[model samples]
Target chain A: MQKTASITIRRKFRVGNLVFHVLVIAFALFMIYPLLWMLTSSFKPGTEIFKSASFLPETWTLESYTYGWEGISGYSFGVFLGNSLFVVALVMVGNVFTCSLTAFAFAKIRFPLSSFWFAIMLGTLMLPFHARLIPQYIIYNDLGWVNTYIPLVLPKFFATEGFFVFMMTQYMRGLPREMDEASRIDGCGFFMHYWRIILPLTVPSIITTCIFSFIWTWNDFFSQMIYLSKIETYTVALALRQYVDAMGNSYWGALFAMSIVSLMPLLFIFIGFQRFLMDGVTMGSIKG
Target chain B: MNGKRREACAGYLFMTPWLLGLFGFTLIPMLISLYYSFTDFDLLTPETWIGISNYVKMFADKKFVGSLGVTFKFVFIGVPLQLAFALLLAVLFKKERRGIRLYRAAYYLPSLFGSSIAVAILWRRIFNKTGLVNQVLALLGIQGQNWIASPGTALNTLIVLQVWQFGASMVIFLASLKQIPTDYYEAATLDGAGKLRQFFSITLPLLTPMVFFNIVMQFINAFQSFTPAYIVSSGTGGPLNSTMFYSLYLYIKGFGEFQMGYASAMAWVLLLIIAAFTGLIFGTSKNWVHYD
Candidate 1:
């Protein structure tokens, strides 16, 4: 009788588990339905896109991809992609170098008024970008740099992103001071100590900073919109906006195709570095 | 120099780039933006000191007030709804079940792309009259309009987009949820408490701090939400300005129309508004936020 009772409980447990799975999966499917719909609809010919609610394309075609790649106004979409990658690369390098340099100081050096400055840095993290945006634009416009990528890339070199500096500082604080002492004993000066010893050890933080900077820069539209005007200089974000505004809904298939192409790099990064992304998000919240 | 002074000097040297950036970009510009708020500084024309005229004009301007209302509505409605979805889903997914990681990734994927222009474009098309939403509506014998193009449903579409990306907040909530000691749950279970009861008495109390954090961060974020409104509205914030998000409006005024002084006033007000909300949350959080 006890065995029968145990069997009955096991059966009930299985039923509950099945229900949980079904519910969880159903919700997940709903969450991603829009995205999947877009992906499938991109393959459908323009006329077929609105004909069915189904995710599967009645007849898949490469027409949209080819057409979107040709781009509008005589510039290819490849130019936009290249421009985006270029900006992301520079921004990544600048943020890493500048944030690390600043972070190393905040983390290790006991500078006079360092805490005061560090506090101010943390304050900037909470600050809305709108606070300085107007003035920054004015300044950039004064420099004759309004329509160039300079406005987008240059500020990053000065470690304008306080979040990374704080993140790297938090990471550097946990690293052993023995490494610093050893470097000092080895007669390494300040530059050597930071460049050779601390930086190599802060690889994880560096990676996190790079991933974030890359994503943020690539996805950045506000500054891109403000600064870039010419078709030749447009990043993916800017060009995509221009494409939609210029083309309207007349070319829905090509629009979706272009949208997918734009998301591909971010998609790869998400798939590959998802764990790091989660770590970055949690680290900011938990520590702050 | 003495060793301590020398070390301090080195520290300053290391911080030079950030210090330069702080002064050149954040600090001085914020000061200038504040200064500009008092003047009629349209880029094409000479900036003249106007003595709070811009601020006064902002209050009187119909479009300015409308945009502010839209922004407030978006912030107040979108954030709380998103947080509720976040906490609910976070709690549901907190269990260490089979394929949990994959589920988490799948859920988190939308958020990673949530604020991007690409997804914003997808949002624009997906809610079109002949888009997927309408296609699905027809299956139920229900007709659908272009949700984004209609003032009534336009802002709601943006809100749904906000809620759809609840995974970002869920990640934060999930992290905190995971940090809650299992021993607490074990103790509750020993006292004959079921999962639902333990969740309320133990879980909810422990989750308060996270709730506060997510609300503040997400509110700030949602308030500044631009790309979706810009893309969905085609940067006009239109269909009778139903989706005129503050930043979008500010962008149009400042950059589009060269209303620098007025937009600067709007920008300063934006800062105050964000600060006020943050302060409000921080003030109230003392009562309910549990800390050990």
Candidate 2:
């Protein structure tokens, strides 16, 4: 009797496990179906896209990609892609330099009102950007910085993004103070300590910052829309948005194809650096 | 003593860029915004200080009031639902299952591009009159509304888009869930506690802090959400203004119409609205949000 009961229990457990996997799989598919549909739809002929909801295309073609690459007016899709890359690259470099340098100060060196300044920095993380948006626009407009990458990439150089600063500070503080002291005892000053010792050790945080800065800057549209008006200077975001006006209902295939092309780089970075992204999420939560 | 002075000097020097940023970008701009809020001006006009007029004008503005209500509904409805989905999936994934890593990765993919223009474009097409949704409905012999064009469903579609990207919150929840001791579940099991009982009595209480964190962060983010709305609504927030989110309206008012001062006033109110809600959540969190 006992042996039979144990067998029954094992069978029940197996069924339960199967059910769990099925449910999880169904939900996961539901979550990702829209994206897959978009992808498959991009390859579909524009006319067939609205004919059926099936995510799979009956006949796939690369014609959309070729046509989409033709771009709007005189600007090719390559120009938009290049513009995005240039802006993203500069923004990432600026964030890495400004955020790390400022965080190092908050973490290592002593100064008057150091704690006060650090608290203020953390406070800025909670403050909404809208509070300063209008005035910042005015300032940028006054300086003739509107319609330039200066308004976008320049802020990163000043550590205007407080989250990165806070993240780096948390990371640097967690590092053993003895490392800094050891470097100092070896006749290294603040710059050398930060450059040769602290910076190398803060690689993980730097990577996290780079990933975030790249994604945010690449995906950014608000400032890009407000500042960039010229067709030549339009980023992928601006160009894609303009495509809606320029393409209207026609060329759905091209629109979808170009959209897919635009997302590829971000998706590539995400797949490659997913571990760092996950770590960054958790770290931010812990600090949150 | 000399070394201390030098260190302090070095620290200040390193902070120069950020200090300039704070004053030049954040702090001083905020002050200027506050001053701007009291005046009236368009792009071409010099600021004419009309005491409290800009603030008063918000009450008379139809779009301002409508957008406020839309935003509130979006935040209160979208955020909680997003958190629910996040928590549910997170709880399910808490156990060590086969292929768990791949599953989680798949689930997390949408949010990576959730706010991007590509998704926005996809979303716009997916809700069109002859779009994928309606086509699918037709296959089942059911009529589907033009989701983005109809006022009632337009906001809901936007809400769905927001809630669809719950992966970030889910990842956070899963992280916290992993940190919970297995012994609690074991102990509950010995007492004949069922899965549902254990979830409520043990898992939930332990998960509140992370829940609170996600809530605050997500709400703050949802309040500032502009990209998806701008893209999905085609920058008009139309279909009877159902998708007129506050930030979009602000952009239209300030930049689109050149009502910079009016936009400044609107921005301050948004700040207050955010601050008040955050404060309310924090104040009430002690009752429900438990932490170790």
Best by DockQ: 1
Local accuracy of candidate 2 as per-residue lDDT tens digits, A171-242: 888899789879888999899999999999999888888988888888889989988998999999999898
DockQ scores for all predicted structures: 0.70, 0.70
- Candidate 1: regions farther than 4 A off: A1-11, A279-288
> Model 1: per-residue lDDT, tens digit, B1-292?
8989989999999999999999998889999999999999889888999999999888898888999999999888888988898889889889888878878888888887888898998888888888778988898899989898889999999988998888878888888888889999989978999989998899999888778877877888788889999989888999899999999999999988898988888989999998988889889888888876
RMSD of each: 2.2, 2.2
| Reference A-B contact fraction recovered by candidate 1 | 0.71
How far does residue A49 in candidate 2 sit from its true spot (Å)?
A: 1.4
Clashing pairs in 1: none
Q: List the residue pairs that clash in candidate 2.
A: none
Worst 10 contiguous positions by lDDT, candidate 1 chain B = B209-218
Docking class of 2: medium
